[model samples]
Target chain A: MAKSGHRTPRTALTCALSLAHGLPIGWCVLPITHFPFLLVSSAYNGCKRIHKEGKVMTFRSLYHTEVINDAGLNGHARVTLGGDFDVLTSSPLQDDPGTNPEQLLGLALATCLNATIEAEEGRRGLEHAAEVKVGVDMGKDTEGYQFFLDCQVRIPQVAEAEAQEILAKCERRCPVAKIVGSSQNVRVHLVKQFAF
Target chain B: MAKSGHRTPRTALTCALSLAHGLPIGWCVLPITHFPFLLVSSAYNGCKRIHKEGKVMTFRSLYHTEVINDAGLNGHARVTLGGDFDVLTSSPLQDDPGTNPEQLLGLALATCLNATIEAEEGRRGLEHAAEVKVGVDMGKDTEGYQFFLDCQVRIPQVAEAEAQEILAKCERRCPVAKIVGSSQNVRVHLVKQFAF
Candidate 1:
C-alpha cells in the first residue's frame, strides 16, 4: 500500500505517466509494470465503432423536452432543435405527410421528461412506482422556436400544489431539459445520413 | 416534384451507387456528383477520420432512458454505462471497482420503470402534467448477480388507490427493466486504447 505523504514530484510524474499510458489507476498506485503477464491479464477488452465520414461541422440547435403531471401523477413532454424545421421526407401517411424531425423531436422530448421524473424520484428517496402521460407543443416562427412540454403523473395520495412543485423541480433537474432550456449552441458534426 | 411512386426506387438506386463509388450521403443527395464537393457536404464529412484509423471494431451497448409522471406533471431519469463501469480511466474510483456496470444496469432497470409509467399514462387519458424519480440497487451473491430498480412518481390531487393500480400496469410495460431483470450475458471487446 502506498503511504499517504507530502506531495512529491515522483508521485505526480507517476500519476501523469499512468494516465498518459491509459493504465488502470489501481496498477498505477503500485509499481508493477515489470510484470508483463499481470499487466496483460488485467487489461479489459471492449470494441468501439468509430464513424469515419463527415467533416466536423458547427451549427446552432436547441433541444426541447417536457414533463407532464396529471391524474395524481407526473409525466413529461418535449421538442428539440433551435428552430422548427421539418425533416424533409417524401413519405406520406394518408392525408398527413409522414412524420418530420419535429415530430420525432416531440417523442424524444417526452422521453427526456420521463427520465427526469425517474431521476428526481430517486433523489427524493422514493421507490420507483408510478405512471406518466406526456405532451409537447412547438411554436415556431421568425421570432425563433419555443417548445412547451406538459405531462401528467400518476402517484398515490399527493396534493395538487405539492405535485406541481415536484414537477417544477424535475424540469429543473432534467439534463436534457436543462440543455434545451439553456438554449446553448450544440456542436455536432453532420454525419452520413442513414438511408431508409 | 417526382411522383411518390418513383421516389423509393430512385432513392435506393442512388444510395447504392453512392456507396459503390465511396461517396458520402451528402454527395448522394446533391444534384451535382463532383467527388470533392460531395465529400465536403456529407454529414460528418464522409467519415474521413474513421477511415484514417486502421482496423475495425464493434461496441455493443444498451442505453436505458425513461419518462416519469406523478399526476399532471412529468420528469425524466436515465442511467448510462459510463456512470457505472468507466474502465477507460487510469484511476478508477476506489469506492466501487468493476461493479460499475451493475449500477448502470440497475439504472437501466430503473429507467425502464419510468418508461412503464409513461406508457401507462399514455394509455390512461388522465395523464397530464407529471414528475418522476428513480432508484437503482445492484448486488452480487452466491446465486450470481442481482439488479433492482425502484421509482417513485408524484401525481397531484389523485387518489392513492388509483396510483397503485397505474404503477402495477406501468411495471408490466417497461422493456429494459424486464430484460435486465432477466438473466443475460454481457461481454466486451478490447480495441486500441488511447491516452488523452
Candidate 2:
C-alpha cells in the first residue's frame, strides 16, 4: 500500500509524490514508519482542505496510481505506484489471454454503480442487494471505433419506479458514472435481473 | 472466451448471450468447437452490419462480460461471464488489501490512451513508445464524492507540440477517453516523464 497512514483531517497525509510543476504548492506525505513526510508540489492547484473535519488538513490526494504502457493495446500495463495492479491488454476480438479496454470499462462501470447503490441501500436500512452489469460493445463511428455500454441494474428488494429513482441518484453521486455518463453511448437501465 | 468466431464480415460473430428482450433479432454466436451458433436478441436493435468488410455478417457483440457485486465496495467483485476477472474492492482510504474505483479508472485510461497512441505511432511509422499515467484523486463534493483525474502523456522521439496534436487525435479515437474525458474533472497534459 502506497498510502500514507491516514490521519484525521487536521493531520492528514497524502501521496508523497505530488509534482514539481513550479505552481502553488501543496503537501503530500510518504509512508515512513510511523512518520509521514510531505515533500512534493504539483501543477494542480485545486488542493482544497475543505474536508469538513478539522479546521486544517494536508492531504492533496487520497490515493495515487501510476500506470505505464509502452506498446499500447498489444503490450503490458503495470501500475508503478501504490499496490501492484498489472495487466496485459489486447483487442477484445483477439484470442489472446489478456484483458481489453471493453472488459476494464465494463468492470469499472459495474463496480461503481453497485458500490454507489450499496451505500444508498445502507442509508435506506436495506440489505446490499444491488447488482450492476455493463456490456461494453466496440462499434465504429464516423471517425473510428466507439463504445456502446449497456448497463443493467437490479435492486431486488426495491420497487421498479423507486429503483429507477435510486439509480438516478446514484448516477449523480458515483464518480465513475459522472465521468463516463457525459457521452451519448452510455445507457443505464433498471431491470429485475440482469438478462444473462 | 465467450466470443464467437471472428469470421469475415460475411461470417462475423458476436456474443451469443445477447438478450431475450423481444426486439429486432441480432445474431450472436457462442464459442463452439470451431463452429458457432447464432441466437439471442437484445433491447438494443442498433446492430448494424456497417463493419464494411464482407458483404454480410451475423455477429452482434464482439465481446461480453457480466460482473456482480453484492456487498458493494466492502465485498468481492467477479466477472460472471467470459474469463474470470475478479478482485476485492474497498475504500481507497482504508488499509484493506484491495483495489478501489480510482485505480480501476486509472488503469483503463492509461491503457486505452497508450494503446491508441501506439496505433497512431504505427500509422505514422514511428516507434511504439508512448507512456501514459493517470493520477486519480478522490475528493468530496457538495453532494458526495467526486474524482479528479490527471493524465500525463509522454511520447519519446516526438516533439512536444506534435505530441499534443497526436493526443488530441487519440482522444477522439480512444473509446475510453471519449467516455471519461467528458467531465470537467479530467485533464490531459503532456509531460516529459512521470515524476514518480
Winner by lDDT: 2
Cα deviation at A155, candidate 2, in Å, is: 0.4
True contacts kept of each: 0.05, 0.48
How many clashing pairs does model 1 include?
A: 125
The TM-score obtained by model 1 is 0.24
Clashing pairs in 2: A19-A41
Best by TM-score: 2
- Per-candidate DockQ values are 0.04, 0.27
Each prediction's TM-score versus the true structure: 0.24, 0.74
The sequence of per-residue lDDT tens digits that candidate 2 reaches over residues A133-159 is 876666544445676676788888988
Candidate 1 residue lDDT tens string, B79-152? 12111111110001132112122222323333334444545566677654333333222222122222222233
